[model samples]
Target: MIPAEDRAEAGRPPARVRHRRVFYVPGYDPRSPRTYFLLFSRELRKFAALHGITARMRAGKEDPATSWHVTADWPGGPVKTTVDCLSWHEIAVRDFAVPKWRVALLSLRVLWDAVWTGTVWRMLRLNWKFGIFSLYPWGMALLYALAALGLVAACLTLAGAVGLPRLAGLAPAALGLYGLLRLTEILDRRFFVWYLINDWIFTWRHRTRRDPEADARFESFARRVADAAEDPSLDEVLVIGHSSGSFVSISIVARARELMREVEGRPRLALMTVGGNTPIAVAGRQPSPARAAMQALVTDGGMLWVDYFAPQDVLNFPWLEPVAAFRLDLGGKPPRNPSVRSARFREIFSEERYAEMAYRFYELHFQFLRANDRHGEYEFYRFLAGPEPLESVTREPG
Candidate 1:
């Protein structure tokens, strides 16, 4: 038999109790928190079985006030994890389903802003820098144009069917345009592009307008985070932000830190941003309140901030450093930047599955939250329920 000290450390029991509280903030999604609970439950079971670990996740009542608890029985000991999904879906739903005219106006406004602020040029530059043309949002504009053309062609076809010889000349155009638009819409939802543009507008308004309801919700979320941080039973408090939620999470955490100064004992706080699109939210607004909040979080040394990006995900800027890209001014010497790690979705899914979803932008963006087919350092379930701490787990990407 091998000597005790020579034995594998993985077989040894953990030195400290494992209790973590996680706050998950979703992106510009209109789904309820129940969606996340269901996703977690499904993914946790699959990952646990694959890793040969005894893990069980039971979702509590579908209420924003309550937490979903997960338990994992590992070689070291049992780990208790409580996750709270801070959902802003209500806001998203209100903004995304506007009338067709409003969508057109918003799309026009987005284009105007892109031109006025050189956002279009910046996007082109990014495409060249990354050597990936998909980084440009031109596909969204093309989809919009095709959708409008399809609607017009449908109207023209109906007119032609009613024996209008004048419109007969447009018949061939109608057939080709309608068929192409339908196929494109089938691949990527037609409204997604408009919804994304509207989300950016909403961010701009939230920063500029300072709406009372939005401010109230922001305060409420920050208070919830502060409550979690102050809980003595928790060893770690992690705030997870995905996509648009990345910028919102930054603001919430900055506000939470402000409120935490009043609390006597706060747990170790950590921030994890996956497939983040923060640069878009803060773009064209230098010296803005949103930028100030982001700067505060980046410079705050007490919290451990880790951001994960996948090169294949075209929605998020993989090479943009939040601090340098934003031109954040931290007083005196700058603190270490957030540990930005690269995650590989190609490794997470099978070759067949990856190839099937190669062009699905949203699916690739969300790969950060799914169950991984290959064992990697960035397993979503393991980060939420495993024995290891998030800080250590995210130190290096596999």
Candidate 2:
């Protein structure tokens, strides 16, 4: 966090009437935090133009110790947004584009866990929920399997052409496999099957058993949240989570609140989960830490929680009651549910642009953060930098 006195020196316009500090937790993306920095820079400028709001953004220096900060000036406010991208890309990079043998072994492990734990049925339900988007993983698995088989066949053909004996063909097959793997690496930059599997593996590890590294990371993130919540200079502390981050955000907020008890006079804390895939991750799991965290959040009365989903994106479950899905007991009373809001992407994009990217499921899932083609409701920029409080903004539909 930047000190109030140093904010002006950091190139932001002096002081403002209100201050909003946003902590963004991105989903299973392996990209650097710089990716988000650029995205915010582009979208904030467009959002300001589209809404006719006088907004100016100053890109701050990236610091791993304090996280990436972007200062935005809007009506009645200059919001300081920090992106806490809790990505294990370092772990993902180790095996994401590795050889076919490694990926095959990992996929088998994921499938076995899903089957043994009855999560396959849960996956089926998720597929039914998200339609084609949910089926993408299965499709990617099949595509990779078929591609490997084709490579094997091509290797055998090359072996025959060279008049090699039976066992001699194995070497050519190995070389062909390596080539195919490299090809998939090039292709996966656009179509992220391998990268998706990396995400699934992380989710699977959390679902089945505790991952020590991931647990430590979450705890560290929660501590950071607690620190921000306790900051006296901040007016509001907003935690925004997208996609797989929704579940992680829930856990972080829950843990942060527990730590917040130590700090008196904490700032207003709010949670906004967009394009959330919590249900998919928690599916078919019994009483677990994730469920416990969800229970804690839904039952907590202090903070406001809003969940945003769009029907157009098959990656997220829209209008789903997370408390009910987690099967948490509220002590025989009605529980407070998160404000489930519909995010209309079609309204956000023009007809031409919508048609162009409508079938691109992954792109649609990210509409939550991108600059809207036309202003309707649910402006991402306003939610972060607007004058209205987040709780009040979500109270009225856009």
Candidate 3:
């Protein structure tokens, strides 16, 4: 009905897409981003059916094992996968009752993958630039030499104590050993912090650089999820963050918004933090620094932030309120009374509503990558689909 130029001027890109639901998952490894694809592929397939869009997911160029796939009616022929519904079913069953020895072996593989793919990847990417300093190599060499010296000195001290009349002389050697252990812990934390900052910088660079194709893909995914609802207006996009993933999502969302001018009328965004450690992203030794940039993005972007805390989750900050800060609890259980609001900034009042889904909480951070049906239901599926949409926006709260 419109002229060609007018129609073209209507938009830089078309608003509608082939699919109605699109989901993106974060990598389970704090240092690497492969786990997200492994867990969410099936759900992505289900979501594709809501709309007539074909989906195809593959590994990032860097990591392949943790990648996934989803499609509808695409030009490419269907992908051949060793994974199928039945395979996942058996894997799930075995994992539920996995033998101790097998689990131990699996844990070792996971550790190896994490160290090699996650840690080593960062080292190679030099994304953080921690070890890239002019003096960093020399400093590290010196530090290692000092550690060796300390080890030898303590051994000598122990040998000297062997001939002492009493065991009192051994105290110094024991103290030295204890000090060495403490120093290791301190170094570990520092190295982790250094790596985090570098990753953050890498992510930030991408956010600012502007990627139209990637943003279009995300917008397509968002619109798909929005269209799946009986009422598109009530379609709420909920982002659930686990462990270090909180950082990735928050950063992505913020970056997405900064690029909003490039794409107009994007979907409204809300966030739920489950066992999140986002603070560590900008966090230094201090409690909380001013991240007005991040805070402003969420605030202006119309984000309804709901943070879930399990008291038992030791990896995240316990006392900080999510709307304002972070909290650590045993699955971060919400109050029984649904009437009680979760926090000042949080829209969802109580955690009781999500209680049955509590097993998804990761007090044990590493459990995130482990295949579990509970996680499939509580964490991933819940986002893709939920109970029937309210007939009206004002429908009674359950």
Candidate 4:
């Protein structure tokens, strides 16, 4: 049932005003030690205006203590709603136009790990190849382990020696331990450097920083949404998951479904997983908790589940028969001289229906939140649901 507030303004035709409160979940820890590329409600406001959808967007930091809310009017008037961003991590993970962003983050993370690992190996290699222990693997292992233990001992001895009258004696002992610990930390940093430069550290940091007991934490947020949308008539509480947040989205939906079941007006939900990372999460021996949770949502809740992928966004998984596949040119419009922009998207989007919907408004994953659209097409943001006739809207300043 439409809200009485919305019903009061329902007379407009071409502008079917309805509330679609979008929750933009940042891909990883929205914030980290380094610079964070933020996604703002203002961007959403712009898209809402273009679509004639009025929206008030609220953004939140990665801090679990905060909340995000948005209410807006569009396509004419008086559509109101609040979006909870902190709680929408799951929806962000599950639905969106492009899955590649998540993939890119994960892939870059893996590559970064590989780089750091390579660095450590190189540092260790020098000793293994030409240092005093070069000839004997077994001997080197024994010596290194012993030396590591000695380093620890020396530090303790140094601390004990610190208050003693012999400062000179303490210096030698402290030096050995300090050098070893410093070396270890340097090697660790070396291992992580690749990710640091590329901005992929955000993913690792968020994952590592998340609590060991994450369920209660996630369940708390899910309950809040369930409580707020308690009125049974709120259509299907559809959840949209995008990029890495897909990991969180699946978990919440499953938990929310269970929690709401006891309520008389439990919501029927549709889990839309866009540019997701389910496959990535499940690629190894045992599926990650996030992947397992996603599967549970589908099996237990009987939720309407759909997944979207874009081939051009090298970051998506190679899952066959995805619910939808979008064809976007991450490469700027196929050379203007050859009418590349017109030809490329048409060629790629023509063969498949899901791809067509997915590609309707193609924005490169990285460029989605950016204001500057170098290729003239907002791409992803412009076609959130798909492309619409924009010629008329473009003529009028919206």
Instruction: List model 1 lDDT by residue over 60-163, tens digit each.
Output: 66754446989989888898998988888887777756754576566566656645765455545544433233223446666667776766667676767778
Ranking by TM-score: 2, 1, 4, 3
Backbone clashes, candidate 4: 32
**Regions more than 4 Å wrong, model 4:** 1-24, 30-38, 52-66, 87-213, 262-268, 300-302, 318-363, 367-398
TM-score, predicted candidate 4 vs. hidden true structure: 0.46
TM-score of each: 0.81, 0.86, 0.39, 0.46
Candidate number that wins on TM-score, 2 or 4: 2
Candidate 2, residue 325: how far the Cα is off, in Å? 2.5
Please give the CA lDDT of all the candidate structures: 0.71, 0.71, 0.36, 0.39
Residue-by-residue lDDT tens digits, candidate 3, 61-148 = 4435532333334333332221111011222232334443343344344334334434333332322332132123234534644875
RMSD of each: 7.0, 6.8, 16.2, 15.6
Tell me how far candidate 2 lies from the true structure as C-alpha RMSD in angstroms: 6.8
Best by TM-score: 2
Q: Stretches of candidate 2 above 4 Å error?
A: 1-17, 59-88, 95-100, 126-132, 150-164, 262-264
Candidate 1, overall lDDT? 0.71
Candidates sorted on lDDT, descending = 2, 1, 4, 3
